[model samples]
Each structure stands twice: as structure tokens, then as C-alpha cells.
Target: MATTAVINGERLWSALMAMAEIGRTPAGGVRRLALSDEDRRARDLLVEWLREAGCAVRVDDLGNIYGRRDGDDAGATAVVCGSHLDTVPTGGRFDGVLGVLAALEAVRAMRDADLRTRRPVEVVCWTNEEGVRFAPAMLASGVVCGRFTVDEAHAARDQDGRTFGEELRR
Candidate 1:
């Protein structure tokens, strides 16, 4: 059977615009610092979208979001794609947001195309990737890949002297 997979650019653009509004700055940049209220809202919106697209969403202690579309073999490893949602104080709308939205669009396209694969597909959102509020970028991803420890990531402090773990729990 012939199948088609087409990305809805308009839908992707709409999603981007919607997210860009979350932490909108006066200078047209986003200030969605990690674990902040803006970050939480963005996470909630993304999770809602993922579930709407038929994915099972999970968030870790470090606040990494994974939206999974199961495959025929539930035990198989997943093919994942995504980027962080949190941004620096002056982060552009397209920097990390585009990759995330594109991945979301891919999942949506797959659903539209009725595509199937042996391995599950997932969209991931890494936490504190910019390190604006926390030190050392790629914090959550580094921990998952062993570059950093959970304690180290949690110990990171912001300008107000609040620990990363403290804000995450807030």
C-alpha cells in the first residue's frame, strides 16, 4: 500500500507561535527559564498536545518530557527526536522550539499517514538545556547520558540562590 507523510507547516507554525507567547519578552525573545511557572505551562501544553496525538507522556524528576507512540513490539527501543522547551532570558523563538515543534509535527504526520514501525517513536523535551537559570547547559541530558549526576544537576543554583531541585519541586 502506498502511504503519504506530509508535515503540516501551518500547524507547526501555529504551535510555535502559541508557545512563543508563553514567555514573551518585550524584545521579542522568550524567557522560559527552566522549572519556572512559564516552563511548567509550556510543559503542560506540550503534554496535552502529545496526548492528543495519541502518545503516552512521562516527565522525570529532572522534568524531562517524553512523549511516546508505541510500536508493535512494546519491548523495542524507541526512535526519539526533540529539543528543549526552556530558553534563556533572551532566547529566540526558533532556537530550540523549532526542533521540538518539528518532532511534534512528525508525530502528527505519522498519525495522518497511518504509518507503522517495529520500534516506538518518541519526542523528548530536555530540561535546563540553556543553563541561564542553572549552570552548565544540557543538564538533564548530561545526567541521563552519565555526563553529570542527579545530585549535581539538582545542586545547581540560580541568581536568587535557589537550588535547581528546589525550583523543580515548586
Candidate 2:
């Protein structure tokens, strides 16, 4: 395995700014709901940055974004970092976004430094972590880890009377 290089801080900051533009509220806050257009746009931006970072990206059945940096040991368990992209109606910046972006930046650093670890590294963005547009929080991770079934999460409704699945498809 090669030693990974340092991630470009400017690039990471740029990615954050780009993603923040989506669903930005008038008061410099984020108003993105789970599965809304803003959320989709933000996810898309993350996808682009992951690609730029040379990560092979995939979206899970639950819409979780995964960026992978393959390890030397293909059979070893992955080193995983998880966070959410979805934000509340008036959520401020630097909450969940920091975690997701930091993970991305770390992966970017590894690539830039040309370093590889024995275990694969994955940067994951759990869908609907905020639950602002739905009921409850932490849906994607809960469902993926078998903490909750898909049906149970889909049945959740937000304050506006919108179901999780419904809001997600919107």
C-alpha cells in the first residue's frame, strides 16, 4: 500500500460551498428536506466531488451515497465513516455536513498522497438523518444496519403530513 497524500483544503472547502448552495435559506441556513429537490441536488454535488477525488461511488437501495477507496486487502472489512446529507428546515451549516465532508476530504487526501490502507475506506452519507421532512431520524443507517425495516421508515410522516417515501420521491 502506498502512503496517501494530504487532501487539498481548498478543494474540500470548495465542495462544501457548492453543496451548501442547495436549499440555502435567506438567513444563511439550510432548508433541505429529506428526499426533496434540494437534497437531491446536494447529493449530486457530493457525487461529483467523490468522482473528482477518484472514488468509485454507488448509491444504496435506500439512497445512501457511498464513496469507496479500495484497499490492498480486498477481503478485509471496510473502514467506514457515516453521516447524513439531509438537513432540517432551518438547520445551520457545519452540523452533519462537516462529518460527511471531512470523510470525503480524508479519502481525497489518501488519493493525493498515493497511500493505501489494508482495509477499504468508505465515506457514507446516510439518507434522511435529520428527519425534518419525515418522522424520526436516522433512516438509511438504521434500515441498512437492520435496526429498522424499510416499510417502517417509509410509513413515517413529517409535520406537513408527508410520508418518508413520498417526500423522498419528491
Per-residue C-alpha lDDT of model 1 across residues 54-114, encoded as one tens digit per residue: 9999988898999999888999999999999999888899888888889999999989888
Pairs clashing within candidate 2: 2-115, 3-115, 4-113, 4-115, 5-113
Error of 2 at 21 (Å): 1.2
Candidate 1, which ten residues in sequence have the lowest lDDT sum? 1-10
- Candidate 2 lDDT by residue in tens digits, 71-111: 99999999999588788788887668879999999998898
Model 1 clash pairs?
Answer: none
For lDDT, the strongest prediction is 1
Candidate 1 TM-score, C-alpha based? 0.96
lDDT of 1 at 155: 97
Per-candidate TM-score against the hidden true structure: 0.96, 0.90
lDDT of 1 at 92: 92
